[model samples]
Target chain A: MGLLKKRKREGGEIPTASMADIAFLLLIFFLVTTTIDVDTGIGMVLPPKLEDDVEPPPIKERNVLKILVNETGQVLVEDQPSAIRLIRDEVKKHVLNEGVDPRYSEAPGKALVSIKTARQTPYDAYVGVLDEVWMAYFDMWDSEARRLGFPDYATYSAAVAEQGAENQIRDKIKAAISIAEPDKQ
Target chain B: MASSHFKKKTSVKQEIPTASLPDIIFMLLIFFMVTTVLRETTVQVRTTLPQAEALTKIDQKRLVSYIYIGPKKLDGNRLGETGVQIDDALVEDMGSVRTIMYRKLIEQPKLIVSLKVDQTSEMGIVLDVQQELREAGALRINYSSKREIPS
Candidate 1:
């Protein structure tokens, strides 16, 4: 017999280490491409705990000039038809005139305007109304402060005096504006 | 002697080397599997949202309270009014909602109190909820809506 055999084993299996790496790469690719979801909302201030022993402020019921927005986007102020665009001016007028009276001028922060919006109303509409309320509040407060001879009086005084020959009218406007400012809690 | 030594000389066997492709592929798969993060779906109530031209994204993690608005159920029939549905009861009065929201706010100062209202629900119902949220000192209020695709 010959020392070496003529026939030899053919087609031996080859080992592969690439499968794990491919799987890992694919997993990484999918993870990097996926997206996450988030929620949205307006800013809020929460009340403190009842157990804190801090005495609660006395509740005073003040008329909050209500602005109601229905599902169809109709704006109603005190049960009257009002345009959405004109809400700021209308609210200003209401806060300064109807919501406040001269008898309550000593207690200017008592008047409040509560904006009641429908849940189904669009976010844009809600924010729009809030912006209007903020503007009206600021305008009314500034005018009132000017009439009362507070610091930075010249700018507000000039704006009020520019209305002309209506000193009584100006005083009434001042009183109305004073009540429009919300009381800080 | 020369004829006896003339035996056939066999050629040496040559071995071919294989590229280490399997090792590379296996490592890539493992890396991806280890790095991938799995996401779980959260339970959400269905509500139709109003469309807007400009909607900004909020990223802060917040405690949200759900408020549902649907028809009032009287007897066995559902009453169709745009009112708040709290704990299986229709809240016709706004004060009750305000009081509850205020209590919740006091309990959790950082709560957001999101409103989930059906699309067909009346604007008045939604507004009432918002007014209550504001009065309760819940300043951070947000509306839940389906994200619109930019076509």
Candidate 2:
């Protein structure tokens, strides 16, 4: 019976001479049709458009840190010629305030970083400065989590394991970086 | 005892089995075909995106629209001007950007306008585009960028 079954299986050897053609054709089709660009970005939510002209509330001068980027991509922090790398430290200092300078904010909740860019500023400079400011907030959050008894937060998944403690802090002290309207050239 | 009894000599030709080669290749081909996404539009602007470390990846492709701003392709025939491309066509004026994007937002209310600008492009042109988008009520913007600076 086993011999009969084996004989029947080998009775007809199917031809595969055109197998390469079929495979090549399918491969070519996919190669031609494939769009492999993996899109990623930095998402930002713009404040909703004003419904009508109303008296905008005035912000205290102490709480606002003005960062100006010029046409030649020079960054100025409160009238100081600041390097792109220093924006993070400057932002950290201002946001935390830490009772160091009364000119800066009193607390993270009160601090607002206003970035005003000239029309001709290079897009690279704009994004570079923005990135540094965000990094400052992120670094603060990391340390904040670690300071709250999660020693392994930065290295291990300690904060995440604590069930929303770190995320709560992140939500409370969101980066309040605002983009002011540009000066028309 | 059964193995010894079944060990009768038989004459058969030894050959490499090539019959299943096509089947294996065809399976791989099918995988590639299933994974491929067709390109919907051809890009006209020459853009090399800037790099940033703090990037947030959007999960849904359906809720996104792309805006390409850069110098016209420096290679072949040059337009001699920076161009803005939205949905496969070069925008002639800044005003039209609002109308076209307003129509897109009508279709997908949760649509996110992704701005892909060249690194060296002036911020003026970009701010103009942003103003148009704001006027169109497309407030959600994603600045498309690479994850690392190329060394």
Candidate 3:
């Protein structure tokens, strides 16, 4: 009977006086140490590395849209000195070549927009050339999307918002821009 | 009309309980501590990545290996000298990139080598780095640049 009888418990609570202080300390620590960096870039998938150079089958010259950026930052579209701003329109026209010029690409699929930059070319110049090429593809996609009834087809966010024919539009607009190995001057 | 309520009022002083405040705060603190990931490496050399209108974000940070190309921070000795930084270390010869990155490729097979190059730097250095990277078989590359919001 005595063993079965338990002592009376005392009312006690956890010491939370310092809880807010501790929380504030931690919040401050994180606030001070946090680095919310927004990182986004141009993604490129490079072909596998080769041990030795190999010869390839010959292809017709009509499909090639050769763009050359020399060491002195001279950008030439099909061996002609082209202004930076001209690259987008020139690339677009060449890619969708309506047979305007005999040297431009015949079709988008057969068209190869090859970018070759010299060793001494400035990074800005090189990226500028690549950006213009990318812009050409983006513009083509935009115009095509606009034709499909999406009037505001400027950025990817605009396309993602629309409900109909997403995959169809995306597949048709996806253009492959091949970057050749850099030529050492 | 409120006489009964007034009559029932106690003389004991009432105090707000704050003992549980720390626990709530601690829980929040722990949540933050667990979720926070320190990814940005302490950059040694000065780098100014070029801006581009089109960009894509790499969701997974683990798959990326940064190759920083820029002039070393001006400290009198290294003024006007452009150097290559792989990860966090400053590498000297361009030839070493292949070997260095090759080991990284072995560790992470699908490594995305992001080139965070300065706009003013010569393309020669970048090309050399790319040549080495190709030889190293670290193919999946990303050109790291800030978003160029039109003026």
All models, DockQ values? 0.17, 0.54, 0.59
- Candidate order, DockQ descending: 3, 2, 1
Error of 3 at A132 (Å): 1.3
Where is model 3 more than 4 Å wrong at Cα?
A: A1-13, A51-53, A98-101, A148-174, A182-185, B1-35
lDDT of 2 by residue, A1-185 (tens): 99877977888655568768878887988978876666777777776666677766788898889999998888899988989999999998898885569889877787889999988889999999888887788788778767766653244244465654445555646688888879755
Candidate 2 whole-model C-alpha lDDT, 0 to 1: 0.83
Model 2 agreement with the true structure over B4-121: per-residue lDDT tens digits: 6556533345688877777878887888877675648878887889999877787667788999999887566664578999988999989999999999999999989999999988
Best lDDT goes to which candidate?
Answer: 2
Candidate 1 ranges with C-alpha deviation above 4 Å:
A1-38, A45-64, A70-73, A78-80, A89-111, A117-185, B1-45, B52-57, B62-109, B123-140, B145-151
Interface RMSD, prediction 2: 2.3
Ranking by TM-score: 3, 2, 1
| Docking class for candidate 2 | medium
Worst 10 residues of 1 chain B by lDDT: B37-46
DockQ versus reference, model 2: 0.54
Q: After superposition, how far is residue A36 of candidate 3 from its true place, in Å?
A: 1.4
Best by DockQ: 3
Model 3 lDDT per residue over A54-156, tens place: 7554656877778888777788888888877899998888777756678887667666677888766788888888888888887887787677676645544
